[model samples]
Target: MIEVSKDGGLLTLTLNRPEKANALTAAMLADLEAALAGPPPAALILTGVGKVFSAGADLEEMQAGLGRNPAWERVSAAIAAMPCPTIAALNGTLAGGAMGLALACDMRLAVTGAKFFYPVMRLGFLPQPSDPARLAALIGPARAKMILLAGARIEAEEAQAWGLIERICAPEALMTNAQALMVDALAAKAGHIAAIKALIG
Candidate 1:
């Protein structure tokens, strides 16, 4: 599920299913696409309502839907194509397809307790190859290779040092800092931001 809140030009989207570690479902993906397509928020922040940012696709549900589902991919692409600057406030662990969701954002800020990993390969599945390019662009090829190939979960501190995360904060302050960053982002000229994003992408 997703919850959206707007304040002073900042729009926050929270993944709100902690019982399942915020695992994404097809309906959630549909909601995300609808939200993204409906309006252009001044700045967007993605976060989790509970301990984990997202554990990834709901494995059990994914298994049932399998090849029949293309919604997740569509939603991911929509998030990546949003015109406004987008940020991911990783409150805790992020893994699997959820990792891809975070990568789609323009900036990422994680809590000190947060961790990141991509384990699609371990599940006997190939990851979206485009994610590697995006990760490399944000961090570097070496770090990206290490993460994807080894499937090692990197902590917030190391991720920040490696340029994977913009900053790391205490859990209590994660949303505060994320909103402050979004404020800064909203202050920038929208055209300029869009142009830069376009050039980079």
Candidate 2:
């Protein structure tokens, strides 16, 4: 499930199926895609409700053919296309296809103790098309290979050092830290934000 909240210029999208580690179902992916379908918000934060941000696609759903779903790419593409700043406020471990979402974000912040990995090699699936390039852009090509090929599970500290995540915060302070990063964007005009993002890109 996904929970959406709009606070003035900031829009927060939270993955809410904590009991299942927020494993994404087809419907959940559909909801996510729909949520980003309208005009882009001034700023957006993608986060999760429980200890784990997401365990990637739901196992049962994957077996039913969700693993190769185009929705994953669509959702990630939507996030990457947003003219406003987008943040992935990772609450815990990030694994599998979920890495695509975080990599698509303009920036990523994780809670201490969080782990990052993409086991597409071991799982016998290629990652969503754009994930590897986005990840490589953030952390470099070799390290991205370490994750996608060697299946290395990167700890939060290592992730920051390797440039995978921008910052690490205490679990309780994760959302606060994320909001802090959005303040400037939220205060700026949407067109101004877009112009700056374009310049940076």
Model 2 residue runs over 4 Å out of place are: none
lDDT by candidate, in order shown: 0.82, 0.94
| Candidate 1 per-residue lDDT over residues 62-168, each given as its tens digit | 68864246775676677788888888999899987777778888889888788888886578766665578878988898888788888878988888998889888
What does candidate 2's lDDT look like per residue over 30-84, in tens digits?
Answer: 9999999998899999999999999998999899999889999999999999999
| RMSD list, candidates in order | 2.0, 0.7
Scored against the true structure, residue 199 in model 1 reaches a CA lDDT of 92
- Residue 136, candidate 1: C-alpha displacement in angstroms: 2.3
Question: lDDT score, residue 38, model 1?
Answer: 65
Winning candidate number (lDDT): 2
Q: Which candidate leads in TM-score?
A: 2
